[model samples]
Target chain A: MTDTALHTNSRSPGVIVLRWGLFLILGLFALFYLMPLFVMLTTSLKSLEEIRTGSLVALPREVTFEAWRTAWSGACTGIQCEGLRPYFWNSVILAIPAVAISTILGAMNGYVIAQWKFKGANFVFSLLLFGCFIPFQVVLLPMARMLGLLGIAGTIPGLIFVHVIYGLGFTTLFFRNYYVTIPAELVKAAKVDGAGFFRIFWSIFLPLSLPIIVVTIIWQFTQIWNDFLFGVSFSQAGTQPVTVALNNIVNSTTGVKEYNVDMAAAIIAALPTLLVYVVAGKYFIRGLTAGSVKG
Target chain B: MAPILDIKNLYKSYGTVEILKDINVAIEPGDFLVLVGPSGCGKSTLLNCIAGLEPITSGSIAIGGKDMTHVSPKDRDIAMVFQSYALYPTMSVAKNITFGMKVRGVDQETQDRKLKEVAHQLQITDYLNRRPGQLSGGQRQRVAMGRALVRDPKLFLFDEPLSNLDAKLRVEMRAEIKKLHHNLGATMVYVTHDQIEAMTLATKIVVLKGGIVQQIGSPSEIYNRPANLFVADFMGSPAMNLIPAKTKRNGTGMLIEIERAGGEIITLHDHHTESLPENVIIGVRPEDIAEAGFRAGEDVQEAECLVDMVEHAGADTYVVSHLGGRNVTARLHAETSAHPGEALKLAFDLSKVSYFAPDTGERLN
Candidate 1:
């Protein structure tokens, strides 16, 4: 892909003009997504006095790192002033296991639904698309009761299991479409060689399905990591994920508004997924193309 | 070697439709058998049934004198090469070759030796560390072959293993497979739709149509003595030409009289007079017909034809002509000067002519 840009300092006159035209459009779109993050970062660096005195877009009257230090260490999160660090740790514990289990089961389920057949595999698949449509709130009460009966309610395991269950439908669907595009004969060759179900999966399908796994891991990590409803509903106060803790700090009505610290906390909460996107950006598009377009 | 595999009245069906009907064959320990037919002829289905990848609705399959009708694919002790060259995409070429050995709990020493030998034969030693996705089509095909070769099972099955290759590669692999068979002397059943592959690879060729066996014989037998009209037409390139001719038996021979387009006629020499029918159809191969200029007048054994088209194929020229209100193709020597919109007398190869019953399509002795 040539990077078409509007007029640049090139010897060719008309070609540079056309190139510059395309670059002008592309640069505008890039700035569209980056502007908000820029504003938030700049606001997080402003002192409280500068924030009250100067406009939001104005440069900080006094530069300081106090807002970040306060957000990380001292700002109160529901009567606790440990700021967002503990909540960030809490989110890590919940997100990692949930993402791992969902991605693994999703790959296996997708592979089996696509390649192997037993009865009701179609039913299993239709149930996935079915879950994709229904909003998460519809299942919240029933899931809460189910977790309470299991006696692990308000625990990390409970939250992780809930994410896996809810995430299974979409993740499996993503994986099924991905694996279905793969040649079924590869799986059959393994079976004729006396490989059982899990053996063929681990050795053949799962390995070839790495791209989709990356996509699945990234998608579910963002979804589970930032999920507020399930984290707060299924978990007690101590086990609440970072999203819930962040919500308590930023949405508090009683305290005087500290927009600088609030913006910093929000950025901190979003950093893991945003960093992942930036690093694996090329892979994300490649994986989607491999899964959907080819299929 | 005595016969090691036998299929007796094997039948398969999907719901209400029959896919394979009464497929029966027997092969010796070192015999190479080929199942061949047009697409949807159920040749692949029959091989799948034998490998126990599919169930047979009737009949039994036996290997090494043991019944394996309901056996699973693994328990049958058979190795199969799928058409798609289904290599494990995640495993290295080395791991793919050793996978079967690993599952069977083979000692690592023996596993290493067999893997090395098969890989060397397939010429994939340099790529032993790469995954299947990283290899070319021909290279992946070799790995698939190695996966099966490493197993050393009692029977080997190949399902159109070269169909995915280019024409040149297909020919190369065809010769390689034949050479491999010579070295191993293993019992193998291979399926392919290519007529040339069937002719070159099989010790016995089974031609199938509409899910039924049309003929089963050696390559020469299939070409020279087809069992019926369908078998005769299906096996040959450009197909055999058939003409309606009147038959008359005298002594030990029969005469066939054919009428040409412009009311000119010719009488064929009667070769087989034993039990000849009055209404007979004469069959001749295009290669058997030769272009000869008319000799003014000859009532005995020459066909006058108007040349319609000329197809030059380097070694010989094929002239398609209109004779007896039907198209007849004649093969001419490269030196034989003939052109379109001309008339000539084409002589049929007397020794190669065959007769068939008009109504039944069966060979008439």
Candidate 2:
């Protein structure tokens, strides 16, 4: 007989019980991750009166689209009312450019600093890494001043630049470590074949680096798209990201809090990145594990 | 053929530690040179230095009679097959093989023609459209070679290219590489730790140790005349039996007297002008010993031994026996009937022996 024969293990009661118990515990933990979003979705469809009188977990007796409708097109802000419809479009416009440009720059920076070695390159890498560990407030003043000097203060460009700069630290860290694990010989192989640095990055490194790129895009989109601090600080009141509008709507003082509209608007603001994760959740997990295992 | 490549007084170091010292070699056109050594003996480092992946500390490397000391690896016109078969995982076999041509702006038709020639030769035409991750290990390795072959460069460097294969596949691929070298008449330098690979593929073999070349010669020459004790030990499997002996001045010549495990004295024929030191060593290949029944003869030397065990492998029997408290092995023809713990007489042929200074481990010849 050949050495490649398959063998089966005899079943044991203790093993069977342990397997079932493992699945049960895992099922319970899965519910923990999902319960909060479930509660929020159900609550957004309930009337304010019903939400106040009813238990948090109970299904609404009267389902209404009033909250979603009000959140979308009708909202009062200190006597003037306009729905989040205008703000929703504004958020997407701000986010798409910010995410794309930031990711591209991040990918380039990751590729360069990871693959090439020049003098003081590690110092540059260390500074970028140092940027990652600092608090957001710490950079707000210097960034504001830098933008002020550049003639882009209190504009979308100002906020866009800040997002890209801050996002680079983490994105480069991710792509740098991931590319470091890639066999250096592949780069040498391409180089030996007459490929230049940019050509190597485009033809060889970029294609194989998809998993990490996907990961960086997912992570940076969420960070920049939902950012309220820079959105409030860098952008003017007229040109603010939708986050500025959402914060204004939710935190208005001496006004009646419309919890349902607030909930619906919150989901609207989060929908793009959340939907992205839903579509490419498997890739996120793959990217994380692939980057980690070699490390 | 004249030499296609020359490396003069090569040196390499990593920070404070020197990895290669004064490595010098010459490769003839269409010649296959195998750099055989243990790991960290600088074989791979030498190959890397030749490929321009690592900078030499001080030396001259010339290809085709032109100095390429500072040439970029790409400008050197050499192709390398890495040990890991470093295929771009995202690229298909055809794309990986044509990547070099594409980068050099060679037109599509020429690229496709060259690609077809290599693919057909390596038997990977059917898998040309598949990415490296989708292929088997052997297939990936073939693509790696195909990637190198498409360039048709001045020289080829292989860094332990077959070390990752299973035993059966290794033998098959070793033969394939030998055939490939023959068909192309390409100058090649191969690195390997496998002695069999060195013996089978090399027109010249360079054995190395601790960043130094111990010997460089044809396989028969290296096998018959290793330059040092380390080379002698490293060159053979079921390694050469190293018998420690004493040297004494006898008449006008020096004599070597070895003490066997059972307190028996055995003399080896001296073949050198250097006076044998008090401590000398004799190295003999296992197959050089045979049965002589403690005979009474001038040329035959005998030692009585108890057979430890016998391993019969179809065509030969490997008999492990004890001599003067040392384990000595004898490879004999297949019909041996010696049993364990039984007394037997083993004979040594004097002409096949190698002598060394036991203190320095240097060969006396």
Candidate 3:
């Protein structure tokens, strides 16, 4: 008789029961975590009167988008009635270039450190890693002075420069760890194939970097987009990001509380990061584990 | 004729830890030289030094009669196949083959022509659009060879290229590489730890041990006349047996004596003109020791030995016995009908044996 015939095909009843029980617990935790988002959505669809009269968790009886419209175009933020439209565009501009520049620099730094290693490569990598640990509050004053000396203080470009510099450490760390998993022979082969440093990085390394690229984009976009401290400290009124604007709209004490508008504005500020995660969430998980195994 | 590749007194080290010491070797234009040794014997390091991948600490390398001591690998007019098959995981088989040309700014027409030629030559035209990750191990190996063949460089380097393949595939690829070398007449240097590979594929074999060259010769020369104990022991399957023997001058020849475990001393005679040392090592290959009367030679000597084990390997049967306090293996005909614990008469081909000085492991006479 074959050894395969001796194996049992069915799992035990206790094991099946235990598996279902574990899934039930996981479902309950998922619902618990999503309760806040459900409340926010329901509240955003209610009128001011309905929001005040109705319970927080109850579905809105008369749905309206008036709160959303006001939050996007007409709400008052720090004595300005221009709302989050301009600031939303500012965050987009800030995040796109900052994510792009930092990610490119990170991949190059990673390639050099991982493959074309020079003397003191480990030292340079450790120094960059040390940068990831420094608190953002510690670098704010010196960064402000540096921005002033560069003569672009309180501008969108200044903010972009700040973000790129600050985000570089994490981006570089991500890329270096991922690139190290690639065999060193690939670089040697490319070098023997008459490819210079930049050419190899462009044609060979960059194409293999999709998973880590998605990972870095999601990480950098979220960090730069939701950054309230850098946004508040480094920007003028016109250059403020949506996080700072959202804060201003939520904290204003000039009139009766508008919970519905505040809720709608907070969701709008968070929508881009949420959308990015939704679109590339699978790749984000894949990229995280990609470096652990070799091909 | 001037040799195509000349390496003069090359040395490589890492912070005083020498990996290769005074490596000097050369081959003619169409010679297939193989660097062979056990792992960590600096065979791969020597190959890397020739390809200009690793910088040498001292001495010079000349390829095609031109000094290339400081040239980069790409400009050295050489192509290499890595052991891992390093076929650029992100590229299609076609792009992987043509990427080198693309980087050097070759015209697209030439790139397409070369790619098609190599793809057809390697019989990988159908897999041109498939990425390396999608291909099997043998297919990836073919693509790697295709990548090197497309260059048509003056020199080719292979760093244990067949070590990653299965045993069956390794044999197949070994034949293919030999055929490629024959057809192209390319000056190629291959490094491998497999002695059989060195024997089968190399026009010239260099045996290395502990960062030093042990011997350099043709396969028959290496097999029949090993320069040292290491080469004799390393180059053959069921390796050459070096038995401790006592020798003395006897008229026009030397008389040898080997003491067995049971106080029995087996004596043999050899034609040697020089006075011999009191103790010397007698080297005999497994095939040289056979059934009595199996080998016909004037120098054939017979001895009775108790068989310790018998392994039937289809074409030849390996019989194990004790000689001079060491386990010695002898290859006999397949239908010998030998059994364990039985005494058998074995013939030693004295003419084919080698003599080594017992002190320094160096060849004697």
Candidate 4:
């Protein structure tokens, strides 16, 4: 019955026109959002002289890989003659460990808070949740002092520590809400089946956490990779992240500004987060909305 | 041998409000003990207390001659099937069934062998590779049972396990569970608010109300002789008819007078009348009252009642009539021509009647 209704609806001229109209509106929005990426790609492919003379919206007259090469290997950022290669690796190193540590810690915290009821559990959860609302700037002074006291000041590990500590609140919030939707009876059943604390979590909860794990990884990865304040404040000369390096290359004062390199560096700095969204964006939405409706 | 399960002086309370009070219950090995009650009656709470999922306020729970009051649930040596079936959604049927064994570090050969045995026993071998989400509700229920069955624990706890299935599936699973119990003869504790499930599945039944145990007896004893007004009203499909009547002294026995809604009085003689109260409630099962012509036995008293309505159930017809200022239903043969606005003679079996003091709702005789 529904199939016939759908078939008849599709055959109507007004329905076809309305559908095409909807597509046209969506196409316009897509073009509007893609305009900046198009301009950046075209600008990165053009020579400096062509860029100075040509329109910003025009396609590249001659596509070239020169800007990408220079941005990755040879472009100078501040006093460094090398390019974003080392700093890109630094960001990768920092974000992987940061995302991993925070996600695992958050999963355990969420498991305890959601499943293991103890005295003052709700209070502790509320306190941890309160951390998510604290602005990043509010914690900079105290965090820097703590990092200095720990003797890892201006180091990559110090930056990692900062990200994990700061990102834990969001990760815990995500995981706890998601885990709350799982029936408490599963834990009870496992308990009766002779499964202990770690056994139940590892054998039961962890395997079921795939969607939320993806969500936490994406969220923490993007937040840490794109971070500028922590990277600029907590890093030494060699440990600067890709975002800081990109900023330096774009804002350097001693030489002629290479617009192509600047655009290429910007896109390079953003490629990880963009690729993450493209690959796992579906689960991000699904995991976010998972526990919204009570099952 | 010691009783398989024992509870003494169990009390569960949350802060100030008490949930369970001074509960004492024990069952021998292989007894199918069912805790049946209405919602908020603490049946589920008592089940959890037994499973060690919830701590008791003050009590000692011993299972298989071992003290388990303070022991953790994993160390309590019990298995439970939840109302929602609580299958690990991410695991296949095989993994779900063998998870407990794998956790205890059982060898692969034993785990696989036990998994195969339980899967086949529950008739879910074909769905061993399927995730719980892929199967239907009844299939998931079977897998839940399989998960518990593989453990072969000393005590099995089921909390309304069949309540989640549809009506037909619930009936089928009910029979299956009964068959499993009969075949295995395993000591089990089941909790449910459905009295029918309790009647059909339990060898021993505990009826609870408002966090207190009302009565504990066999199914026949609970059906034939309820301890109080609550049990008489709670059990049975059509519910027992409770009629307020007046009592007077006779030669040695007593004379019970029940006034109908139209002010017609019917008197009955009781054999045991020592210390009988002036006012009392008479409890009788619906099937005990039958058409006058169809029933002829000792201690039977016949009375003509104004039929209010007639419900034609397939095997038996229910005749609702006015008696003692209340609606009394009598189960009669389906071919009877009893109808509304007409008088029908119903024979009340006095031998099976129960008398309770009207004030306390406690059984008098």
Q: Name the candidate, 2 or 4, with the larger DockQ value.
A: 4
Cα lDDT tens digits, model 4, B1-365, are 79999999999998898999988999999999999999999999999999999999998999999999999988888999999999998888899899899888999999989988888899998989999999999999999999989999999999999998899999999999999999999999999999999999999999999889999999999998899999999999999999999999988788889998774798888766656789999998999999897778767889888899999999999999877888899999989989899998889888898888888999998
Tens-place lDDT per residue, model 3, A1-295, is 4555543334467778899999999999999999999999999999989877878899999999998999999999877898789899999999999999999999999888998889999999999999999999999999999999999899999999999988889999999999898888898899889998898899888988999999999999999999999999999989999999999999983768988899999999999999999999999999999898655
What tens-digit string does per-residue lDDT give for candidate 1 at A19-76? 8998999999999988898789889999877888888777677788888988887778
Least accurate 10 contiguous residues by lDDT in model 1 chain B: B292-301
| Model 1: CAPRI class | medium
Residues B1-365 of candidate 1: C-alpha lDDT, one tens digit per residue: 54688999988998889998888899989889999999999999998888887889999999888999998888888899999887776689899899988987899999999989998888989999998879988898899889999999888999999999999989999999999999999889999998889889999999999899999999888877777788788877767788888877767577778877765577776654656778877888887787655222232256667788888888888888876557877777877667788886787766767778879898875
Model 1 error, position A253 (Å): 4.9
User: What's the lDDT of the predicted structure labeled candidate 4?
Assistant: 0.92
Please give the TM-score that candidate 2 achieves against the real structure. 0.88
lDDT of 2 by residue, A1-295 (tens): 3333322233467777898999999999998987877777888899989888898888889999899888778865434367677766766777778788877877778788877866778999999999899999998899889999999998777777888888888988888888878888888788788888899889888887878888888998889888889888887656767777777777762556678788888888788888989987899999988966852
Identify the superior model by TM-score, candidate 1 or candidate 3.
Answer: 3
lDDT of 4 by residue, A80-134 (tens): 8688999999999999999999999999999999999789988999999999999
For each candidate, report its DockQ versus the true two-chain complex. Answer: 0.62, 0.69, 0.82, 0.80
DockQ of 4: 0.80
Question: Which runs in model 4 stand beyond 4 Å of their true positions?
Answer: A1-18, A292-295
TM-score of each: 0.91, 0.88, 0.96, 0.96
Candidate 2, pairs of clashing residues: A73-A83, B260-B324, B261-B323, B261-B324, B261-B325, B262-B324
Taken over the whole model, the C-alpha lDDT of each candidate is 0.84, 0.83, 0.91, 0.92
The most accurate candidate by DockQ is: 3
Interface RMSD of each: 1.1, 0.9, 0.7, 0.8
Q: What CA root-mean-square deviation does each model show from the true structure?
A: 3.8, 4.6, 2.4, 2.1
